[model samples]
Target: MEELDFFKSPDEFPPRRGGYGLVHVDCVGKRGYTNSALVNLYAKLGLHRYNWLEGTNFELDSIMKFNMRGAASPYYITLVACLPSSGLQQIFQVLVEEERLGILDLTCPISRPQGTESSKKESTPFLRPHSEPVSATHQDRLLGWTKSVIPWPSSEIGFSDTKRFYMLNESELQCDWISLYVELAICTSHRWFKARDLSNFELEIVQVAIESLHDKEPPSLKSKAAVIYIAYKDLAKARTGEPYHYQAVVRRVINEATGTLSIQGDCWIAAAATA
Candidate 1:
């Protein structure tokens, strides 16, 4: 036989179309052995919490063994943006209820230090100048009301910055007048639905509540509710992409009756005015 070149033989390429070759053998082993083992392990562990996880695992297995050759992994990215506050609150409530029912373990630990600090702070008395004891007198009662109702270390909600406005009343107004206004504001916010909206419905509720307030008798003129002339105006302003504006009044209502409080007549803004 003549000398043949071993390198030139077609068999050197391992017969690309043959059965059970190295490439086929490796692929089959990965799919049947390694990939299957991983899938089985994952299934046994039950780690598929979300739909994305299960889908991702399936894609990964198919790609690794070249069974369904494509991308090496499923690149999935989800972006949730600008969730509404109301929806967020509902979700939080659901989670809390679930935890309460023992559907899920509590993820957060209770902090004893914070609890202790709060308790200690509560025990300390607030030292305000001329802090007279609260009494049946209008002044004392008003002071007492402010201290008890208003949260200490007040934020924007407290209207603490407007404490001067409250104090300025001392020159010309009585404590009952101030107290009644504060009480009305606080109670309406606490009792009514969508109180923050201050819409027509809220205004009606507030009016009714204020009318009810006038039924009570105060010891002095200073203690009476201020006669307020409420005027709702559209200054055409938007806060955080929401159409809102200065819903205002000409004066604060202190003492009033079922009949409307008269301001310079032009001061009152009713639905008719808005229309």
Candidate 2:
């Protein structure tokens, strides 16, 4: 009904009693999603990702209908989309994950909706459906890992379980977008960046480690089941461009029942000693 942005806190939303209306359950199974705003946004996101990966422009025509299942963030959605080029509407299943930082990770799988047999025969000028399991080699192809070189004592090698801060050398930090997520996290409603206090943050991310097992983590970080610790060297150019080392603590809250995710960030910044 109103303009929507990624900034809204999902947890704060007052629960709706029912969906817009009960739609027919043909093949895709899920409760109807009432948010018309999200209906357009999520559908576009799904199509955007699909077009990017498949190199096909099956333009979004209108938000016909939407259904959300799993009751959480990474929702499996089925919607109708038509190609502006041909006005042929097709059903597609999309996976959309709402991140804590208000970012979305939407993906489209390779499948023809509404009975693959019939749709395959009816749908015209197909893309040949070059499908591959993304999860099968997702890490091997896109992500690179180095394994943290931080040498801890053998006794402190790792927690009895992965319940404590374990070294993570996940090198996804080199990308500009991942760096942007960290940048947004640094502005966590704190006044530190106001009045030109700590602007021009140039970060050289040094390490990415994760900690679990709530009991051993900080009280604030313990709010979530797991934590991602981003260690980096920063330059506050608004000042003297002086370098400072800080570890920003990122907390992710996941609703296990619905598999929805919410994230918050915090950091304790201390300047590097005078050179």
Candidate 3:
């Protein structure tokens, strides 16, 4: 069921950093950042290592700071997987598709190998090179996999506790998680939405936003939510760039709003009782 002619050139393909490319951001803290948030995010997704007497299965390979040069983006920590057997290719393929489909939350796209222009043009829908290695670009940093050897199953996250923004389809969705991923996508696209580049990710976010805006809640609440979402994103890029403290401050502001909501709920209840 494979397309042989599509794989034209008999020439050997160059080596790849074969494996799953699960991308995550490592928000550098005031001092040193920790990978705990990253590890916690993974663990929340029900991914853990099985340390058997015979051998280990499903382990963390590396967590490195990638070269993601974006305005509001934080340093990336790529979590590589050392599978039990050799399903690296399939895993990578699925991860790529999931990221594209917005099933998994990620800030960057999967990296392609170095290859010639002709071969790149002939690359499949999944961007797998047919002939030579796909050419590497600056965007490769977003894939979270570079050639590095590190110890597995690191605890303590990092020296400093890190914060991660991940969303897995299998888990219950978070309002903030959805907004965060959408805002990140908008930022990477330079805040411009082009239909040509719009796909499942774009469509999914738009659908959610629309539904949120049109929910049974009051119109004022919906408008306020949208305004807050936009304002937070704008503030993230204002002056300080993206820092842990900055995010913490923003989070406090958000929590204050949440607190206000609780007060409002009490007031509403009282008003109803009087009525």
Candidate 4:
């Protein structure tokens, strides 16, 4: 694949053959995202947490703003996902993985109407295991809403595409903003950073690690896996340093003989804006 330019429109992607593999729409304000912003987020999480296939391939189909019909015209964004059926399955499986990580309610409803009977109930149905009920308080605790404020997936039915773009109608399926940014981190290609762009400091680290592990850089280091980068953003949490934000695109190498996956690695400080 050619080097990805995250600054370009994310909507520019290949077409899906199967009818709207998995569509997700959410009402959102205009919060434009850049390629570097997503790269920063991905570096923080790493590929293991945000699996390239399970999380990043979901494409942004469209972002539409529609006026409320009756009330004063307040506009909101509708984000669409167009992935292959297998991709859709992978997304759900990732949700199951998150649940295994202890957030149980992947498909919880954000809120019900005031005075709804379900709102009066003490428990909310967890979706992954299907039909398992947990107390609302415990559910909130396990999901870390009070502590970390991580966005959990909550689904709703029915959305409108007033402009008729993509020939979409009222009956189609779509995931929402939480599914895009919070659940998946809205990614495209998996290559995070190119090692050729590494700063001298970062290159030195890679070279030393490689010499210690394999006595040389792997043949595929330049071509196959050059862009796997690392970035450090939250410095106040760090034990030492001046606490300035810094980022690097790193190359991680493994010597199967050593039985270690990251025995050798290198990084390049991003020459771009760190914020």
Candidate 5:
């Protein structure tokens, strides 16, 4: 599933040598100063991750107030997201630390954010996160052997099936996991921060597959859950950026020892590499 920083505080203390200082930015009003497109992207991405893991469908309606503090790389963003399903909203905070294409800290989208005194308490999140009890395993298998990987499993609560790979029905591909995968497929494929020309181009993914060793009882080695995604980089947003297909192996960091179903970023966008 897709999930979700640091910046200096405009309202806080001064920075020291080799040190990061917590920031407190002053907002104009209840809406805060978080109207940037990138900030909006982060809010949506975090909600996407939350939906899959919690088994709830909370769409982002709008962004309320937010506080940020960081220089460039790892930015700590605390934002309140309004859900369309319910007028209420949920407050989320995260840490971002990736160079090329990045997501928030693995430990982010913190179930509850600090100072939860929003106009809409936990109305958005409180009504969601309804995952059924699972014995163990991932609903979406990251292990490869197939040309496509079903975003979520229908029958099994967990991916504890003895078989290494399982097939998914066409109907089952319409879950939040698919959105998470697609979002990941696009972002993870473009990890070149220095490549300035690639930003405006569009992206497409196909032959998506996954490979993992975390299935069995006690499983095998820990190689981090990986998805072998084939993406097309179109230099033109007209869907003709040279459909160069290559494998994009990506992973999400979760705490296996505790058996938590959510995409815990031990800190988002856990691992990315080209093969």
Candidate 6:
């Protein structure tokens, strides 16, 4: 089963920072329940401690948060057993095909083995060889596809020409809990969609612009929700690069859902280039 591959890396573990982990189940109906079941199963298999609270199993979260001091290494593998067995297999087959087709070229480097001469080599390349670069036309096509798929607030949904942009699939979007992953992708490509820093007045102006444009027909429910969340979070972060304040504003806006529907931030004005 496709889920078998997730469990195949017995030594692999999750990162210390908390993030979403994809889990496939034998059946669509079992997806939610299997999350808990697998936790118990793994714990019983001596994987780690398991706890169930209010019918929610947190085994995956615990394992991902596990820290090993000194010689101990935490195991952080996330497994999902998907159902309609054939359906799961088909999804994986498509993914593998995409990888082979160069449709998905996202890859990262792995550290060399410790205590090895190769590890000591200064000029050794860590990334996979034969990696291909996406052409500008391909990037434009991808961006256009993303714009078509995700309904923006309106034509007036102004994006900074200075910022970079990126397109993420549903799975990849979900895996990026903090949104840093997406930002990294954009920065790597040297494209910008949102500015990283702005004053409170600048943030207010952007929010007001968005609110002014929001009166039009809303996008699909998913798109609308995502856009709202993204606009607010990104705006807040742009004004203040700190997470705590951004999250506080997010929580406040979320709590005052009605008022939040309307923007009440600072205003924006053009700034001159500094010498």
Question: lDDT for every model?
Answer: 0.21, 0.43, 0.24, 0.23, 0.38, 0.22
lDDT of 1 by residue, 49-119 (tens): 11112121211112112111111211111111112333321100000000111011111111111112222
Taking the tens digit of each residue's C-alpha lDDT, what string does model 6 give over 1-275?
12222222323544435633433333223323322322222222221111100112222122221111111112223333223324331111101000111111121111111122222222343222222221222111122122224333343543332122223334433332223222322222332222222112122111211111122323322221123223323344444554311210110011111101111111111221111
> How close to the true structure is residue 59 of candidate 6, measured as C-alpha lDDT?
21
TM-score of 3: 0.20
Local accuracy of candidate 4 as per-residue lDDT tens digits, 88-146: 42211111112221211122111111122321122332111222121222122122222
Instruction: Report the error of model 5 at residue 24, Å.
Output: 7.0
- Model 4 TM: 0.21
User: By descending lDDT, how would the candidates be arranged?
Assistant: 2, 5, 3, 4, 6, 1
Off by over 4 Å in 5: 1-38, 63-72, 99-162, 176-207, 217-241, 244-247, 256-275
lDDT of 2 by residue, 1-275 (tens): 53321122333344556632223222233333244334444455556545544556665554433334333344345667777787788876554554322222222222234333322222232334433212221111111211122222244463344445555445555633334336545543331343133234577887665564245443222233445666676665425754476656554433322222334454545333332
Worst 10 residues of 1 by lDDT: 89-98
Clash count, one per candidate:
9, 2, 12, 10, 27, 19
Q: Quote each prediction's TM-score.
A: 0.17, 0.34, 0.20, 0.21, 0.48, 0.20
Off by over 4 Å in 1: 1-124, 133-232, 237-275
- Measured by TM-score, the strongest candidate is 5
Local error of candidate 5 at 256, Å? 5.6
Candidate with the larger lDDT of 1 and 5: 5
Judged by lDDT against the true structure, how good is candidate 2? 0.43
lDDT of 3 by residue, 157-246 (tens): 421211121112223233433433343334322334332222223212211211111233232222212111111223332345432111
Backbone clash pairs for candidate 1 read 174-222, 177-223, 225-254, 225-255, 226-253, 226-254, 226-255, 227-254, 228-253
